[model samples]
Target: MKGIAFDALVDLFPGLGGWHYVPVPTEVRDAIGGHTTRGLIPVRAAIGTTAWDTSLQPMGDGSHFIALKAAVRRAEGITVGDRVTVTVSRR
Candidate 1:
C-alpha cells in the first residue's frame, strides 16, 4: 500500500491538527499522589492537555504508560508547538 504524505494526513481527520492533544486524565494523576496544585495539566500556563503515555494511545497501560505534559499552542487561532514531557515512576 502507498503511504500518504505527512502534511496531507491531517486533512483526513478534523479532530487532529498539527499534533494530537489528549486531556490529562485525573485517574493517572491520582495514582501518583496527585499533583501539587489543582486545575488541568499539572504544569502552569497551560491551556488544555493531559498526562499520558502515547500521542495516539493514552488508554490501557496502567502502571506502564509514561505520563507526559501536552499543551496545544495555536497560531492565528489554529494549532502548533505541541510539547511532551516523559516521566518515570519511582519503585
Candidate 2:
C-alpha cells in the first residue's frame, strides 16, 4: 500500500525500446512538478471501507522526488487516518 512517485511513473509509460520514446503526458508532467517524490496514485476501492488497500509499482528512477498536484473526489464514507482507499480526481 505505497504511493508511487514520478520517478516510478516515468517507467510505466507506453514505449521504452530503443528509438522508442513514449513521453509522459502534460497532466502527469505537470503533476510531477519536476521533483519525483510523488506519482500518479490510483485508489483501489471506496474510502473508509475496511477492505481498503493500495500498492505502488516503480515506473522510472528520476533520481529525485517529484511534486504532484491532483484533486480527490470521493463519494464513499471515509475519514482521516481511517486507512481507507483513495483516488485522485484530477492531475
lDDT of 2 by residue, 23-56 (tens): 3333443442433434544333222232233322
lDDT against the true structure, per candidate, is 0.28, 0.28
RMSD of each: 13.3, 13.5
Q: List the candidates' TM-scores in order.
A: 0.22, 0.20
Worst lDDT window (10 residues) for model 1?
A: 2-11
> Considering summed lDDT, which 10 consecutive residues are worst modelled in model 2?
64-73
Cα displacement (angstroms), candidate 2, residue 49, comes to 28
lDDT of 1: 0.28
